[model samples]
Each structure stands twice: as structure tokens, then as C-alpha cells.
Target chain A: MLLNVQNLQAQVEETEKQILKGLNLEVKPGEVHAIMGPNGAGKSTLASVLAGREDYEVTDGSVDFDGEDLLDMDPEERARKGLFLAFQYPVEIPGVSNKLFMQTAVNAMREERGLPELDMFDFDEYAKEKIELLDMRADLLERSVNVGFSGGEKKRNDIFQMALLEPKLCIMDETDSGLDIDALRLVANGVNTLKNDQRSFIIVTHYQRLLDYIKPDHVHVLYNGRIVKSGGFELALELEENGYDEIIKQHQDA
Target chain B: MAKKLSPVAQKARDFYLHEAGKLGDASSGVLKQVRDQAQEAFAEQAFPTAKDEDWQYTKLTGFVQNHFAAVQTSEEVAGKINAYMPSFPVIKLVFVDGNFSESLSDDLNELPDGISLESFADTLSMNNELDKVFAGQDKILAEPFGSLNSMLMRDGFCLQVSANKALELPLYVLHVQTKAGSISSLRNRVVVGENSEITLVERYVSAHEEGAACSNIVTEIDVAKHARVKQVIVQQQNDSSYYFNNQFISQADSSNFNTFFASTGSDTSRHQNHLYMNGEHIENTQNSACIARQSQTVDSRSYTEHNDEHGFSRQLHKFVLDDKAVGVFNGMIRVDQKAQKTDGQMDNKNLILSNTAKMDAKPQLEIYADDVLCSHGSATGQIDENQIFYLQARGINKAAAMQMITKAFLLEPVEDINNADIRKWITDQLEVALAKTHLPKA
Candidate 1:
């Protein structure tokens, strides 16, 4: 398995209100899993917990990635361990150029992997290739990180970063939000281009529109801190047509 | 142990007292009023001791004990004045013992229209609307050393740029402390007319034959409507001197003011810059950088007030302290309720290059306007260790990596300077300052 989760439970800081209650899932390599949910569900919490956001406390859980303990690592450490999270809302770091920040992150990951650091020329070549694939403006790389970018531009930048990092497991949290049709197509294209049999992805979304572009091998309905129903891609179409009411009712009946 | 006066300081003090006595009674009624008030204030406010909060970082006892006499007007310093003219040809004003030298000064005949640069004493003698310019402005002149400056000031520079006029060349004023052991106080008043533009460079340096000289100087700038002014203060006094300087600037509507301070001298120095934006649509940019070494100490305090609506201010100060030196920065930004839509940002970053060296940075913001955005932050730390290690791991030696990081820390603020020439000059000086500092281990 590329990612293994067992009896996961998590809570927000200083509060006993559980956000993730005994969530269990597993993903093997090369599989695309879609997690669909309504508002107030544990979709974002699960994504944050896996990505090591400092705010969420994993009260009871065991997350193992490729046989290595995942929960024990820092956010940056998890990033170095081939785990990438495309944040719903990207942070803006002023005075730090995008090129410098991306290069630093890439070099940090490369250093951890025991790979030789890319020289300036080589780094430029790699960055150019990824940026071209994403069809992003090359000038944006010289500007300050995420400063003054539009919502759609920020989302595309997130995917662009993911493409650059080339993580083994990519967790894209609502990457389709705030994006127009054109931006959505470009983002989906970037993801499809980077897809390979050796890597896996966990796509979390509130709407089924994004799943249509990036087909998923399996779909799960997460409701009120738990994944209540699991099925194939057809399940996404069923939920999209009937809404989440039937799934919630069926889970309660069971 | 009694603090002994350096022979040079004694001579400077004698020169100051002699000049003050020669002025015997204040010549002009306005001068008499200002002088009397300043003397009383100076006598009432004892010299700031180490216990004083503002003066705690700087020790002034060694250079303050000797009551130096102010220098009288002299034709003898003309040779000294001509020797130090900057390489670039430009109009120059030489002040010896606070007194201006006309023979050494450039003739104003060739000056552009609507601009006036003359000796303060000459303006006083002519009674050329001096009262209208400085009348009732005694609060700023009443500070301890400021009062001293008012009471003892004999000769200084006075500049007035007419409305809507832009000077083709900069006005360079050199304040030379000629005699050691002399307490010299110089006062300068500059008025930028409405819609006019000008650049003023004030350079302070101790005489070659320096002793324990104390220089207390105050300069006031009044910027009028739609005007632009750039003021650069360069202080490179003798290492054995004690210097206290204050700059008070007031701005009118829609004006822009840029002030830069560069200090790399004096054993103990304190600089106070107070700015008041009294009109709408005014903007102020203030930058200060200091490099201190040995037992030197530099303390800088600034207050920026947004008294009108739609005004903005930005301040950036960087300090590089090494050896047993200390640098202190206190910046305050205040936005009144009437100053709606005001935006203020202040940042003070310090680089401490030694274990014994220290920096104290305090940035405060007080906003009474709900529509205002005011933020102030201060950070004092050594260079980043991780950055240093990363550079060192890349085949660069530890010492070289440290030098690179330290240089970057100092250059960060220098890069904000808009003038290319000034930026290059400051960068070169920063390199020299860093060379004198001890690089930390990676």
C-alpha cells in the first residue's frame, strides 16, 4: 500500500470536539481515490491531519506511508518524504521570490533523498520544463511568492508546485474551488500529464464536477467525521444525481 | 576615577565659550528670546545619566565632563574648509565653530532662481523675515542639547527654496568641529517653498587634530505644499567625540520627504528625528543605517505623527553592531482620528556580530483612526544558522559563508535606497563595516 490509515481519530486544539472519528482507509500505488462530502464533514480535517498541519491534533491514529511512520514527521519532513498537499488556500510569503522559494523546497527534498543538488543552470532547465507543462506565465516565477495573484492563478500555482515537487502521493484539497472553466481545464490537464503508475493521488472535493475531469478508480462518501459508504466511480454520479441525503439516510439505517 | 579631557576637546570647549561671550547680548530680540529660553532649559535638564532610559545604552561621561567653549567666527579655518571640499564640483557652505564663512562659501550669484543659501548670521543681520520662519517654534528648541544649541549657536546655514522652483544642484553643508575640548552647538533652519524640490546633504566631521569635542546640533526643515525634499545626514565624527543631534521636520499638503541617516563614528552618539505630517496626502520615507565598532554606541529615536487624513509613512532602520559596541533604535508611529486612511509601516532589523555586542530595537504604533493600517515590528538576531550551514556545505568555507550572510543582512535595507549612486556608496561602506566585524561560525 502507498498509504495505510488505521482507526484514525483527530481533534482541533484545546477542544474535545472530534473532527475525524475512527476514519480508516488505504490506498495502493497508481490508484486515484476521490473523497466526496458535504459541508462540515471531516474531508479537510483528514487532509490536514495527513499533511501535518500543526493545528490539528491526531488524538488516536496510525498513518503509515510506504511502511514508514507518517504521523511522526514534521510538515516539511512529510513533504521531503514524498507526501505533498496542495493547500486549499495558499500562503503568501512576501520578500521571498517564487523562484528562490521553490528552488529551496526542491533542493531540500532532493537533499533528503540523497540526490545531488541541481546547479543553477540545471535547476532553471527543470523549472522551465515544469512551468511549460503547466502553461503558467514564466514571469510569475520572479515575483514574490503568491503575492497579488488572483484566486484562479493561486490554484494553478499550487498545481504547478505539485508538478515541480513530483511527490509520490499528492493530496489535492479542493483544488478546483474558485477556478473558472478555463483554469479548471488547465489544472486538470497539468494533473493528467503528471499522472504515472508509480504514484497515487487522493482528491477531496465538495462537488462532483472536478471528478469528471480527473477520473477516480474509487469514490467514498464522507459524512459527519466518517466515511459511511465506499464504491466505484459510479457512486460519484449517483451522489451527484440524488444528493448526499440518501447516503446519510442509508448509513443511519444500517 | 575622574574623566580626563582630551587636549583637543579642551581647545574646542574654549573656542565655544569664547564665541558665546563674544555674542555677549543676543543681537536680535527673537534671538534673545530663543537663547534665554534655551539656556534655562539646558540648565534645568541635567545631562542625561546612564540611569536615563534613553541614554542607558550610551555612556557619555568620558566626553561630557569638559565644558568646551564654542569657536568664534574665524578666517583662519578657510584653509581647512578649502581642503575638504568634495571631489565633485558643487556649491558649498562652510561653518566654522557654528559660524558661516562667506569668503569660503560659494557666491550665490550663480545659483538658480527662487533658491536662497546664505549664512544664518547674515540672515539674522539683515533681519530677512527670520522671525516669520522660526518664531514661536521653541518647543523643539527646548530639548536639553537642543536648548544648548540654541543658547550657544553663533553661525550656521539657512536655506530657502522659492515656490515651484527646483534647484539644479545639491546644497552641501559641512559642519566642522575645529577645536577639541570645545562644546559647539550649531542650528540650521531650511524651508522648502511650495511645489519646489531640493536635496540637502549635511556632513559632520571632527577636525583632524581631534580631542574630546562635543557637538550638539539641531536642524529644522519645513516642507511646503507639493514640494519634494531629500535630506541625507552623514556623520563620521572622531571616535573620541560625544555627539547629540536632532532633526525636526514638518510637512505640508501633498508633499514628499525622504531622509537618510548614515553614521559610522563617534564614541557616543544619539540622534532624534521627529516628523509631523500636518497636511493631507503627505508621504514620508525615513531610512537609517549605522555601523558601530569598538566601544562606540549609537542610539536613534524617531517619532512620526499623521495629523491629517490620507498621509502615509514608512521607516526602515538597520544596525550592524560589532565588538563591544551597542546600537539602540526606538521608532513610534502615531495616527490621529482625523488622519483617516493613513498607512504606516515601521521595521527595525539588527545584526549583532559579536557575543558582547548588543542591539535594542523598539517599534511602537498608536492608531486612533479606524480606517488606518499601522504596523510596526522589530527583530534583533544574528545571521541565520541554517542558511550559513547550507552555504558552508556547498564547498564554501564556514567563515566565507558567514560573511556572505552578514553582508546580505546589511544589504537588505541598503537595497531599498532608490538612488543608485547612494546605494553603491553605502554598499561599499557596508562591506568595510562587515570586514571589521568578526564572522560567526557556521
Candidate 2:
């Protein structure tokens, strides 16, 4: 399994408010799992807990990534170990050029893998290929990270970083939010292009629109805090036709 | 009744009196009168203590107790400052141990037409414009350290540019301190004629680090109508050094002036800046950055007065303090009643990297003009954990992320420098200082 979460329980660190109550999931290599849910269903919280955000505390259970305990590592360690999370709201780091930030990140990951670090000239050439692949503005490399970029542009940038890092397991938290139709297609296309038999994706979203572009192998309906129902790809189309109310009601009654 | 003076103040006064007595018959003229008045002010207003409002955040008792003798200048120390000089084409004026070195500096006679750069002492008697140049002496003499500099300063620089002339190369003034436990008093004057342009860079550095050296300096600049002037000052003395500076600038009609000041050295430092807008439609920009660590303290205070209509000014100051270091910033903006349609903005931001670091910032706006648009803001914060995590998620370690953020914070103040070479030089100096800093984890 690429990632395995068994009965994960977490809460907000400051308020002690339980956000994810016994959430369980399993994803194998090359499989795309779509996590669909309504508002306040702990979808984003689950992603945050997996990404090792300090704001959320994992109270119980274990997260295993490629036979190693995922919760024992820091965010950077997890990133070095081939786990990537595309943030819902990309951070704006002013005065730090995107080229420098990415170059540092890339060299750090390279050092972890015992590979030779890429210098500025080599990194610029390497990043230029990905910029062209994503059809992003070349000038974005000279600008500050995410500063003055539109919402759609931030998401595209995150996807561009994902393409550069080439992680084993990618957890995208609502990457389709705040994107127009063309932007949505561009983001979905970028994800589709990166997908292969060796890589896996855990897509968390509110609507089923994004899943249409990047087809998922399995669809799970999340209610309250846990995965209430699990089914095949047809489940996403069913939930899209009849809102999450039906599946949520069935889980509550059961 | 006479006020009691601190040990440092007494030593300075004794040295000045002995020096004046030695001059005897040679010290006679308007300069002598000015020096006498300054001596009186320095005597009355000795070294400021914690009781004074401006000195509240900066404790000077330890500094005032040190017995610093006069600086000793020598021809042998000329080659010590080559490492600090930027690799660029420029006319250089080198000052060693606070005295101008004739052999080390570039030839002043080779200067372009309409531009004059000479030693302050050499031009004192021959130049009749000295009276108008010291027009702001009264206000400067009010401060103890300013008056002390005026009373003891013997050599510095005088730069003048004629009307409608622009210089292609920047004029660089380098001050190198080589003696230990000594004091160097220096004064500089800059006057730019109407419709002219120039760029000036003044740097202060120390070659010796064993004992503390003190540099007390005063600089006055006059910007005529339709003139443009850009100035950059970088102070990177050794850890065991004391730096005190007073800068007075006046702008005429339709003129523009921009200045960038950065200090990342010295155990104790203080900078006082006073800007006067004398005519209408003038624009002014002032930016400052300071990095202090290991019990060092950096204090900066600026007061700007807008006396005419349609004046615009903006000031941004930032400081990065760590390891029990202390930083103080007090900025004041005053718009006169007759200065209508004045737009002024002042902002101060500080980043404290250590648990025990300290910063005191006060931004004050006093506007008597009802129609002016003025605003002042001061903010103090540590590195945001979210920003760190954002970098960490991208595979950067926590320490590297903190250092990157700190560098970015310090670079923002100098981003507006027009000359690329000057900007690069300043950035290079800042990077060297930043590399030596040890930032605690966020």
C-alpha cells in the first residue's frame, strides 16, 4: 500500500475540538482515491493531519506510508520521503523569488536522496522545462512566491511544484476550489499528466466536477468525521446527481 | 550653575578645550564663533542619560564611562580597507582613523566639470559658502553628541555639484577605523545645485576588533530646486565599536531625494536624521535596515518637517534582533499649517528571532495642516510559523527557512535603490552580515 490510515482520530490543538473521528483509508500505488463530502465533514482536517500540520493534533491511531510510521516525521522529512501536499491556500512569501524557493527545495530533496545538488544554472534549466509543460508565465520565476498571483495562478503554481518534486503519494486538498473552467481543466490536466503506475493521488474535494477530468478508481463519501460509504467510480456520479444528503442520511440511519 | 558631566563627556570636553587653547591666534573667524557656541551647548547638554525621553530605550552609562582617546591616523593603514571596497568604477575618498588620507584617495583634480570634491578642512578658509552651508548648525548644536562632533571634528569631506550637471559615477566615501579605544569625530557637507543629479555612498567600517572605537559624525546635505540626489550609507564596523551619527537634509522646490541606511555592526549605535522640506512639490524617500545580535543595541530616530505645499514623503524602517539584542525606532512626521496637500507615510516593522530579544518602536505623526494626508504605523512580530511550515513542506529545513525569511525581511528596505551597482553592493554587505547571524528556530 502507498498509504494506510487505520482509525485516525485528531482534533484542533488549541480548542480541543475533535475534527476527524476514527477516519480510515487505504490507497495502493497508481490508484486515485476521491474523497467527496459536504461542509464540516473533516475532509480538509484529515489532509492537514496527514501533512503533519502543527495546528492539528493526531489523538489516536496510526498513519503508515510505505511501511514506515508517517506521524513520526516532520513536514520536511515527510516531503523528503516522497509525500507532497498541495495546500488549499498557497502561502505568499514576499521578497523570496519563486526560483530561489524552488531551487532550495529541489536541492534539499536531492541531498536527501544522495543525489548531486543542482546549481542555480542547472536548476533554472530544469525548472524551465516544467514551466513550459504547465504553460505558465516564464516571468513567474522572477517574481516572489505566490505574491500578487491570482487564486487560479496559485493552484497552478502548486501543481507546478508537484511536477518538479515528483512525490510518490500526493494529497491534494481542494485544489479545484476558486478555479474557473479553463483553470480547472489546466490543473486537472497537470495532475493527469503526472499520474502513472508508480504514483498515487488522494483527491479531496466538495463537488464531483474535478473528478470528471482526473478519473478516480474509488470514491468515498465522508460524513461527520469518518468515511461513511465506499464504492466504485460510479459512486461519484451518483452523489453528483443526488446531493450528499441521500448518502449522509443512509449512514445516519444505519 | 553647571551641570555635572559623565566621565566620557568630561574627557571629551577636556580634549576640546586643550585643542582650542593650542590653536590660539589661528582660531579666529565665524568658524571659531560657531565652535565656541557648540562647546557651550555640549557643556550644558552633556551626555544624555536614561532620564531623557530620546535616550530612554538606549542606555549610555556604560558607553559614557569608557575613556576613548583621539584617533591616530597613519599612512601605513591605507591598505587595510581594500577588502571592504566594492569592485566598481568610482571616485573614492578614503578616511583612516577619522583623518582623510591624501595618498590612499583618488585624485580630486580629475573630477568632471561642474563637480568639486575636496577635504572639509582644506576648503574651510577658501570657500565663502561655508556660512550658508552651516545654516542648520543651531538645531544640530542643540543635541549633545551633535555639538560634540562639531566641536572636535577636524577633517571630513565637502562635495559640491554645479547647476544642471549630472555625474555618471557615484562618489564613494569610505571611513576605516584601525585604532583601538580611540575616537574619531568627522563632519561632511553635500550641496547639489538646481537641475543636477548625483549619487553618493558613505560607508563606515573597522579593521581592528580587539578594543572599542567610537565614531561621532555629522553630515549636512542641501538639495536645490529641480535637483535629484540618491545617497546610500552602510555601517558595518566591528563588534567592539561605538557609532553615533547626525544627518540634516534640506530640499528645495520640485526636488527629489532618496536615502538608504543600513547598520549591521557595532556594540552600540545611534543615528539621528532630520529632514526639512523648504519648498513646494518636493519628494523624499528614507529607508533604513538594522540587524543586531549578542547584546548589541541599534537606535534610530528621524524627524521630518513639511513646510511647503504639495510635498510627498515616505519612510520605511526594519530591524532584525536576536540573542538578547535590543532595537529602538522612533520616527516623527510633522506637517506645517502652511503645507497644504502634503502626503506622508511612515512605517516601522521589527522581527525578533530570539526569546530574549527586545524592540521598542514609536511612530508619531504631528500634522497642523487639516488638508494633509498623513499616516503612521508600527508593527513588531516574530517569524510566522505558517510561513515557516510553508517552506518546510517544500523540503527546506527549519533553520534554512528561518534564515531565508530573515534575509527577505532585511532586503525589502533597500529594494527601491535606483542604481543597480549600489543596490548590489548593499545587498552583498547585508548577506555577509546575515551569514554571521545565528537565528534561533521558529
Candidate 3:
């Protein structure tokens, strides 16, 4: 298994409001999974916890990634360890040029793998290839990171960043929310290109339309902070047509 | 018995008293009255001790005791421009010991038609109408240092540009204090004609190696209808010097005024900038950044007044305090009753780089107009740890990560500089200042 979460239980600060209650999940290499849910189902909280956001406390859990204690690492450490999260709201870091930021992140990941750093010229040459692959404008690299970018552009930028980092497991949290039709198509195409036997993705989304562009092997219905049912990709088609009411009702009855 | 003055202040006082004999007779009755009143104020206020509020952060006891006198009018410091010239192309004017040095200044023989650059004393003597320009404004001279500069008023530059004339190069005023133990006060008056545009760069530097030196300087800018003026004041005095300066600007109808201040030196420094928008549709943008290290301290106070309707003003100031250094900022924006439809914004951000470093930022807004947008905020905090961690995770070591974060903190305001050349120059200076902090490299 590439990632193993065993009976994870977590809560927010100073309250018994359990966001993740005894959740269990496992994903192996070369597999894609989709987590679908209604509002207040702890979808974002789960993603944030996995990414090591300090606010989420994993009260009782064991997360093992590639034989290492994943919860013991820092957020950046998790990133260096091939855990990539495309934030729902991409952070805006002004004064840091996109090109420089990407190069720094790439070099950091390479350094973790005991590789040499890329000089300015080499980094520029390398970034150009990825920029073109994503069909992103070359001029965007020179501007501040995500500053003054449109919603569609920010999403594209995030995907481009994911491509540059080349992580083993990419967790895209609501990456399709603000994208237009064309932008959504482009983002999906980029993700499709990055898909391979050596990597996997956990795409979290609200609408089933995004799943149409990039199909997932497993679909899990999350309701009230727990997984109510699990099925194949066709389950997404069923949920899209009928909505999430039947799944919630069946889980409550059980 | 004579009050025992510090060796430096004593020499400074002697120098100024000697130079006073050479000054031309007070040109106008108003000038004489103003000068006498200034002398009285200085004698009464004297040099502030540690108790005064304005002088609390910056101690001037040693500077006062030095009693340095003023420099003679004819004294000149040669060959000082080569090392300290601004990185940008500018019309250079050199002043030594508060007196304009024509030989060291750029050529003005073939004037640019309507533009004028001459000595204030000469301007007042040649044109009777100029007397009213400097006529005793007691309100402006009420401050102790303001009165001192007015009384000891020596020759300084007077720049006037005609309507619709936009100079290609920025005017650079280089004030060099070469004489040690001499209290030097330089006063400048600039008048931007109706519909004209200009950029001014004022650099304050010291040539003295050591000893006590104090500079009490004041500049008044008159911006007219539809004119735009950008002023940059770069003060890089010697680490051993003392300086107290004030800048007063009044903007008329539809004019825009932009001011940038960068201070990196001086043991103790105080800078005051007051902007008044007296006509409709006027706008002002003020920016300031200071890097204080070791025992140095910088105190900046600013006031923006909206006296007319439909005016706007925005102010942003940032400080990076390291070592035991202290930085203080007091900014106020006032909207009068008739100043309806006004918009004002003020923000001050401080980055404390050391445990011992201290910063005090107070932003105040008093709005009487009902239909106005006014906001003021002040924040003081250490470097963001998350930002630091993000950089470090990207292969930058802890030290380089901190440097990058600090640079980003200042760059927030530095990037607001409109001119490309000025922006680049300020960035380069910031790099040098960062280097001087002896921050460990990543």
C-alpha cells in the first residue's frame, strides 16, 4: 500500500466536534480514488489533516506512507515526501515570482532525493518545457506567484505546479470549483498526462462532471463525516443522477 | 559661568556664530521677524533632553553638547559626488554646509525655457514677489528645529517648472555635511507650476569622519493645479551623526504628490512629513521604509489633511528592526467637515527581526465628513514562521530563508514605487542594507 490510514479519529480544538471519526482508508500504487460528499461532511478537513495543517488534531490515528510514519513529518516534509495537495483556495504569495518559486520547490524535492540543485539557466530551460506542456503563457512565470491571476488561471497554475513537482500521490481538493469549461478541460488534460503506473491521485470533488473528464477507479460516498458506501466509477453516475439522499438514508438505517 | 558643552557641540556653535556675520541683511521685514522669532524659540526650547515626547526615542544629549557651529557660505567639499551619485540619471545640485555650490552643480546656463533653479536668497532679492512666498508663516515655524532652520536660513535651491513641462530627468539635491561639530540647517522651497510634472531626489549624506554633527533641515513644496510631483528622500548619513528634518507639502486643485523615504544611518534621526490637500480633487501617496540595526533609532511622524472635497490620500510605511534598534511611526489622517467624498487609507507594518528590537506604530484617523472612506491600521509582528518554513523546505537554509522573508516584507512597500529605475535602485540599496545586518547566508 502507498498510503494507509488505520481507524483515524480527529477533532477540532477545545470541542468534542469530531471532524474525522474512526475513518479508515487505503490506496496502493497505480490507482485513482474519488471521495464525494455533501456539505459539512469533513471532506476538506480530511484533506487538510493529511497535508499536516496545524489546526487539525489527529487524536487517535496511524497514517503510514511508504513505510514511514506520515503524521510525524511536517507539512513541507510531507510535500518533499511526494505528497502534493492542490489547495481549494490557492495561496497568494506576493513578491515571489512564479518561476523562482517553482524552481525552488523543484530543487527542494530533488535535494530530498539526494540530487544536485538546478542553476538559474538550467531551471529556466526545465520550467519552459512544463509551462508549454500545460499550455500556460510564458509571461506568467515572470509575475508574482498567483497575484493578479484570474480564477481559471490560478487553477491552471496549481496544476502546473503539481506537474513541476511530480509527486507520487497528488491530492487535488476541489480543484475544479472555479474553472470554466475550457479551463476545466485543460486542467483535466494536464492531469491525464501526468497519470502513470508509478503514481496515483485522490481527487476530491463535489460535482460528478469532473469525474467524467478524469475517471476514478473507486468512488466513496461520505455523509456526516463517515463513508456511507463504496462502489465502482458507475456509482458516481448513480449519485450524479439521484443525488446523495438515498445513500445517507441507507447508512442511517444500517 | 558658561554651560559646559560637549567638545563637538561647542565647535558647532562657534562655527555657526562665525558664519552668521557673512549672511546678507535680512531681505524683507517679514524675513527678519521670522528669523528673530526662530532664534527666540531655539533659545527657549534649546536642545531637547530625554523628557520630551518627540525626542524620547532619539537621544540628542551628546549631539547638543557638541555645540557644532554652522559652516561658512564659501566653504565647499570637492569631489564628493563621484561616490554618492544616485543610480538614476538626474539633474544634480550639490550643497555643502547648507550653501549651494554652483561650481559643483550641473549646468543651468541654457535653461529649459520655463524651468528655473537658483538660490533662495538670490530669488527673494531679485524678485520682490518672492518675499511673500517665504513670508513669516508662524504655524510652520512653531517647532524648535523649524524655527532654527528659518533663523539660520542660508542659501538653498529654488526649483520652478512651467506649466505642461515634464522634465525627462529627476532633479537630485545632494546635501553634504563636511564640517564636523557644526550645526547645519538647509532649507529648500520648490514650486511646481500649474499642470507641470517633475521628479525630485534629495540625498542627505555626511563627509565628516567623526565628531558631533547635527542637521536641522526643512523643505516646503507647493504643487499647483493638475501638476504631479514625485519626491524621493534618501538619508544615508554617517552612523555617528544626528539629523532632524521636516518636509511640508501643499497640493492644489487636481494635483498629485508622491513621496518616498529611505533611511539607513544616523545614530538618532527624526523625520516629519506633513501633507495638506487644500484644493478639490487633489491626491497624495506617501511611502517610507527604514532598516534600523544595533543602537540606531528612527522616528517618523506624518500628518495628512483633507481640507477640500473629493480628495484622496494613501500612506504605507514599513520598518525592519534588528539588534537593539527601535523604530516608531505616528501617522494621522484628518478629514474636515467640508471635505466630503474623501477617501483615505493608512497602514504601517513592522517586522521585528530580533528579540531586543522594538517597534511602536500608531495610526490615527479623524473623519468629520459623513460621506467618506477612511481606514487606518497598524501591525507589528515577527517574521511569519510558515513563510520561513516554506522557504526552508525549498532547499534554502534557515538563514537564507529568513533573509528572503525579510526582503519580501520590505518589498511589499518598495514595489509600490512608480518609477522603474527608482524601484531598482531602492531594491539594490535594500540588498546592501540586508548585507550590513550580518545575517548568516543560507
Per-model C-alpha RMSD: 9.1, 2.9, 5.8
Interface RMSD, per-candidate values to 1 decimal: 9.1, 0.7, 3.5
lDDT of 1 by residue, B1-442 (tens): 2233455544534544455556765655776777666655654553556666666766656655666666564337666776555555557877665667676777866788778777667666676565775663576654667766776776577788989999756687877777776666777788999999887777777765557677787788999999999877777778877788888999999999998887787888888888999999999888888888898888877989999999989888888888899898988998998999998999888888778898878788888989998889888887665454333222234565567556655666665566566567657755765676666543
Summarize candidate 2's per-residue lDDT along B1-442 as a digit string, tens digits. Answer: 5567766767756765565445442377767777787778877776787778988888877676676666544547755767877898887899888888888899999988999988877766576766775677898897788888877777789899999999888888998888777777888988999999999999998888777888999999999999999999888888878999999999999999999889999988998889999999999999999999998999887999999999999999999888889999999999999999999999899998889999999899998989999999988999989889989898888898998988998899889898889899898888878777777443
Worst 10 residues of 2 chain B by lDDT: B17-26
For model 2, the DockQ equals 0.75
Worst 10 residues of 1 chain B by lDDT: B388-397
Give the CAPRI class of candidate 3. incorrect
Q: What does DockQ give for each predicted structure?
A: 0.04, 0.75, 0.20
- Model 1 chain A TM-score equals 0.97
How high is the lDDT of residue A129 in model 2? 95
Q: Give the TM-scores of the predictions, in the order they appear.
A: 0.63, 0.92, 0.78
Q: Considering summed lDDT, which 10 consecutive residues are worst modelled in model 2 chain A?
A: A245-254
How would you order the candidates by DockQ, starting with the best? 2, 3, 1
Per-chain TM-score of candidate 2, chain B: 0.95
Q: Higher-DockQ candidate among 1 and 3?
A: 3
